[model samples]
Target: MLDDFMTRATLAGIGVAFAAAPLGSFVVWRRMAYFGDATAHAAILGVALALALELSIFAGAMAVALAMALTVSALSGRGYAMDTLLGVLAHSALAFGLVAVSFLSGIRIDLMAYLFGDILAVSRGDLGVIWSGAALVVGLIGWRWSRLLTSTLSPDMAHAAGINPRHEQLILTLALAITVAVAIKVVGVLLIAAMLIVPAAAARPLARTPEAMALIAAGIGAASALVGLRAAYVLDTPAGPSIVCVAATAFALTGLYSVARKAR
Candidate 1:
């Protein structure tokens, strides 16, 4: 069954959707969209690091993403504006990664694959890694759901309840890094934030509770992945961007629905 590349790709997409669901919901609630982008952009640097050190791409991406997320978390509220800091780091990381990749003269790397993903080419091992990482992310978020939610809704309340908001933020940072590392193969660094944000945003209009939003987002994400892959195959388009396009469409539809509901 897994012998089919398409089957592997489908499973991989679903796995990623599940992982993105809870974390993405938190990201939306916290307004951490740019933070997600910054962490994802840093993955390119991880790619360069992996290539340089002969390490697993996943490991390298995870390391650099974690480092970037941590750096931003640490530097936040320290005189430098959040958006400005992220802007500088995000662009710098991408530029450095691109230049570093160019320096690897002996290696013939398809940088497009890293930037835009090659989901159809996912191997069985890759599928395993995706699923494993997905499971870990899901479990981690599940364990911290209540605390994270408390922190997001009100840091003061969380502190009163003895749940350190900063610790919860760190958990999210760690999870975000893992998601970026695993998602690189599905949507690439350039579009990973779309995968994280679009589905959640799409679900926001339709869901009343946080849990419902996450579930709906997961369903939407899975649908987008499957539909996007099918559309990509049929239209001969790039799979990664195709997936993001589908998610964007969902976002638009949901936004329209929200506006129409408000008018009613």
Candidate 2:
């Protein structure tokens, strides 16, 4: 099974979807889309760091993504507007990462693979890492579901319930870093946030409850992965973007459904 690239790619996509679904829901609820983008973009810096230090790319990506997320979380509410701060950090990290990559003299790295993913080249070890990260994320989110929900709904309410909103936010930050690390091989840095948001956005119209939204988003994400891989193979298109395109299409269709339902 692992010998087949398509099978591996399919499993990788499903694994990422599982991890992203719950975290994506929290991101949407907290209005943290920019936050997600910033963290993902920082993965490039991780790639550079990995190459320079001869460490695992996954380790480098996760470390930098964690740092980026923590920085954003810390800097938030320190006077700068959220959007402005994220915009500055996101682009700066990406630019610095690109510069860092250019400094790697002897390495013959393919930037496009990191920037846009190389899911079809995933190995059995990569699949193992993806599934492990996915399970950890899902377990972490599930364990903190109620508290996270309460904090997301209202910080004050969460404090009253003896839950620390900051702690919950930290948990999410950790989860986001893990997701970025594992998903870099599936959708790459440029489109990771789309995979995180679009499926959740698409699921919104069909779900009446938060739990339902997470499940539906997971389904949509997994479906997009499978469909996108087939489309890419048939059309000779890039696999990562094709997956994101399917998800974007789902978002558009669901948006239309929402508007129609509201009118009728």
Candidate 3:
């Protein structure tokens, strides 16, 4: 299996899931799903820029995602609903990126690959990038765990405890950007936010606390990666979306169990 392309794909998916779990919990708790989606969508623009400039796709994605996150944060109270703002920015970026990609001459760009991911095509170097980026996300979250939770609970309470909620939000923004960058190879831009949100949602019914939710989400995410990859191999489907299908299946099952438990 070590010599197989599927092995690298599995490892890459697993790395992305573990990093996304905790970040996804915060996205769910803070109601930043739209923000996450907007940023992920903006990655298409990053891909265009990377190809144009001959730079690393990861670096380009991280830079663009960070810019998108910061732009959203700066526009938070500017007399517009967050959803409305994100919707405009997200779709606009995607449209422009697609147009830009169409203009690239002399290169056969497989737009579907970037949009939906080419996980089975991941190489050893890509695995190194995925795992390294995953480690960075985990370490950053662990360092700011308490502060972030406190801020999520209440900005006023965070202030009373000398924690700036905005700063914590920015920290999460940074982490989110990094996640999108690394995850581009594994799940691509279109499904990146799903990777962030689905496992956390699935884990919620089984968890009793914030910490438990994070750990459970990670386990759910890892399971989705493993199961989804095997299923994709067996069924001849797209690996990235298959992983999401597994996570969505988990979410459906957990939701049903929660409802049944409540009825009983």
Candidate topping lDDT: 2
Which of 2 and 3 is ahead in lDDT? 2
- Give all candidate RMSDs, comma-separated: 0.8, 0.7, 0.9
Decreasing lDDT order of the candidates: 2, 3, 1
lDDT of 1 at 98: 93
Q: How well does candidate 3 match the true structure, expressed as C-alpha RMSD?
A: 0.9
Q: Give me candidate 2's TM-score against the actual structure.
A: 0.99
- 109, model 3: CA deviation in Å? 1.7
- Tell me the tens digit of each residue's lDDT in model 2 across 151-251: 99999999999999999999999999999999999999999999999999899899999999999999999999999999999999999999999999999
Better of 1 and 2 by lDDT: 2
Residues 1-264, candidate 3, lDDT per residue (tens digit)? 657998888899999998999999999999899999999999999999999999998999999999999999999899999899999999998898899899888877889989999999999988888999999999999999999999999999999999999999999999999999999988999999999999999999999999999999999999999999999989999999999999999999999999999999
- In candidate 1, what are the lDDT values of residues 213-262, reduced to their tens digit? 99999999999999999999999999889988999999999999999999
What's each prediction's TM-score? 0.98, 0.99, 0.98
Instruction: Report, for every candidate in turn, its global Cα lDDT versus the true structure.
Output: 0.94, 0.96, 0.94
Task: List runs of model 1 lying over 4 Å from the truth.
Answer: none
- The runs of at least 3 residues in candidate 2 whose Cα sits more than 4 Å from the true structure, single-residue gaps closed, are none
